[model samples]
Target chain A: MPDTGLLLYGGAFGLILIGIAGIVLSAHLVRIIFAVALLEAGANLLLLLATWHQGAAAPIIVAGRVPDLMADPVPQALVLTAIVIGVGILALALSLALRVQRAYGTLDMHEVRRHMEQDIADEAGIDMPSSSHAPAAVQTARQESGA
Target chain B: MQRLSSALFLLGLGLLIAAIFRGMEFGTVAPIVGQAINSAAAEQVGAANFVTAVVLGYRGFDTLLELTILFTAATAGGMVLGKRSPTAKRDPDAGFILQAGADLLFPLLVIVGLYIILHGHLTPGGGFQGGVILASAFFVPILARPGTRMSHTAVSTIEGLAGASFIFIGLLAMFGGEAFLTPLMGQGELGALLSAGSLPVLYLAVGLKVGSELAGLLAQLSESEAVD
Candidate 1:
């Protein structure tokens, strides 16, 4: 069973890595968010199972009750913390997605960037040689505008 | 591409499992878990469950952060879905059988959740498990009646109070010349439910806090779409 649990544990980890890969490779922000959530869940379950890992005994300490499955609480603590953080990140990301949707006509990152460039230039007065030099132009503008 | 992604995911999962097994092989994690459960002083933590002890006592700071995450998530979820009056109403089409069944299950869940929280000193489960169970019970109601709007103020009040109480107990112990959360009162009753003095109280607070926060999240999610 240790082998089996290890297999389950390994499988969960693999899913997590894939989910993370999905997040990184995907073009869609929502897909990325879903990927991230899947990663988080896989991670959480893995942590919980760690409490049952072979090397560790069950968390129960018994006078005579017979100690069984004993995985560490430290990881559980860490995972709990991670889960909370994940929830906050999910919510914050969701709201940001909403805000972005409101600002731009679409949620596509590629399209939004195109629309944002014009807004950026308007708000930031481009005078440099090219679009690539927009940062330097903005810096010069800021200095010209003065504190 | 779909098949490829799935395959890659499975491979990564396999490696991750290996990592977990490798971790178990290290033997560092088990000793600590076993000892905490077997401690003679376990009863003082106000819990009957050892897992609860680790969660609410020996390593409570982690739990604190977890609550913060839930609270923040609930609040953010409110912000997202609450921003717009979503025309996406709750699907009122559930068969009466499913809805009624959930209603019956609610009380049982509540009892089990309470059991989990209360036994957290001597057993494996703790306030977190119980709290989530309680929250699920609440979720059922929201599912049944999607129009229900949980009072944000009330939820926050409960969450804040319970959280403060956990810390306050810790502070009290500190004042009494014990280390933080060092159950100032009881001896380890071993298998008894009420043996772990302050632990039970801590678990109580945790359960209350978790239950309320989760309920609030469900309430927000169930309401009309958040957009503005």
Candidate 2:
């Protein structure tokens, strides 16, 4: 029996929480991208909720008559801008993901990270960090040497 | 052990957010600027949609900056996804039904997109929504017929011109002793198609710029070689 406001706020917060969990928990690049999108959507909804009013009509004049109560227009305009920006960022992210997949031949985040670290170390002409999840042989060798 | 930590961290985060939410008031804040804009938008901008007035008339510069961001993202995306090799295998054309459906939907989408954009001042939909539709209109055809390449040169040209004209219109207002992007010309009769002074023109430019930019970006993404 929660009121409309509580329900809306709950939905927005739930979306945000889910999106954050997705971003933090998912290892796949595409999943991460989608999570980012979900987070953006949740944020947009929260923003729109900030100015919510009960029984408010859309902020449009029809037939030369203004309604008794009109919803806030500024937030709507801001949300429109945010949405377009989100789309642009998503497209860029996907393209970058595509490049990363092509370059590394894998989309798994941990594998990609390992490859990238290796590449960077190699470029720097330094040995790979022992702390990294390198091969079992390398780990054993480092452990034996330490012992 | 990792899962346990992650779950604990999420629980803490959720509790924190819930605590924050509990203290805050909802649906009660007075929208000072919104109320002011709603009262004055009709006479000042002559647009039925007050949101449109705020977008193209009051906060036009923000819209312009948004367009720039979209342009930058699209350009960087294109750069990231470089030229598809001539020898790379392309996705085969879709089935006959899909191709036929695409052909059927193309004109309808274009018409609807244009209607939404042109009637933005009086409707719920506006440049951004309509522009996405327009983009899909072009992109759907490419999805159906992979061989039919969209002319990147033409898209870029249209995008550039549309973006320029948006700025040009704003600058024209500056010449007439007003601030940038100030809605010019007669406000005309409210609710009429041609009534919103320069707002409709601004939206037209926005719609075209967004549509072309998106279409080109999509085409580039589709053309890139699929990673195995």
Candidate 3:
């Protein structure tokens, strides 16, 4: 039989890689958030996996019989807290995504970025009323590109 | 091109992780610290559940910080998503059968959640899990009748009191005991309902705090207007 440790490690890494791929390749903000959740789940899995031992009983103490092999309590505690924290973070991210979608009228990252850029240019143009408010470095780069 | 690059990136990352994990064996080796904890857990804490002891007894400080993080997220989510525009459409109430079922099950869930929280010292379930369960109990009714509004002030008050009680218990322990969060009162017989002094109380506070916070988050998310 394959070692459970190696299998768990592989699964965790696979989840993380898949999530990263989803984040990088997907344009939708919701998909990105889902990917982030997947990343967290992978991390949590890895943490729990670190504590697993063959023939181990759960950390619970039985009445008369002494526990022979007990899994690590510290990592279990850490992972338990981490799982809740991850959910809270995921909720916050979803809220931010909701607000962003409302303001920009789009969930696509590219579309949102374009809208943001246009808004920034409009605001800067209004504020300056003369030369564009583009940063000196960016202006120089744009000029070089045009030339 | 994007797909190819992403695949390449993932492949490299996977290789790196595999290399890092290659030498490790699964479940074959017992942790040094775990051995000590298991031995001491039964004797010192008198809590049947070792994880609960660690969470609410040994490393209680971390649990406090966890509560703070959860509270902050709930507050932030509410702040960002609370305001409803005039043009937003309300979701209709659920069907009669679903609503009836939700109504019947809500109290039962709350009772179960409380039982879990109260028995945390003796069992596998703890404050965080019970609190989430409690929050889900509240969520059922909200789902049943979308138009039914929960009192924001009441929910916040429940959250505030629960959180304050948690801190108050910890501070009380600090004053009475040698260090902060040192369990006050003496440990009773193991596996008894009244055993594991202060652990159950702290778990109760955590359960309430988490329950209210998550319920508020759900309400905020459900009632808020979506992007057009």
Scored by CA lDDT, what does every candidate get? 0.69, 0.92, 0.85
DockQ of each: 0.22, 0.65, 0.52
Residues A22-103 of candidate 2: C-alpha lDDT, one tens digit per residue? 8888879999999999999999999999999988999999999899889999999999999999999999999999999889
CAPRI-wise, candidate 2 is: medium
Q: Best candidate per lDDT, number?
A: 2
lDDT by residue for model 3 (B1-228), tens: 556777888888878877887777766666888889888988788888989989988899989998899889888988877688878888878999999999999999999999999999887898999999999999999999998888889899999998899889889977875677878677899989998888898899999999989998998898886434
Stretches > 4 Å off in candidate 3: A126-147, B1-3, B226-228
Candidate 2 residues lying further than 4 Å off, grouped into runs, are A130-147
TM-score of each: 0.74, 0.94, 0.91
Best to worst by TM-score, what's the order? 2, 3, 1
Write down the lDDT that model 3 would get: 0.85
TM-score of chain B of each: 0.76, 0.96, 0.95
lDDT of 1 at A136: 64
Residue B203 lDDT (model 3): 91
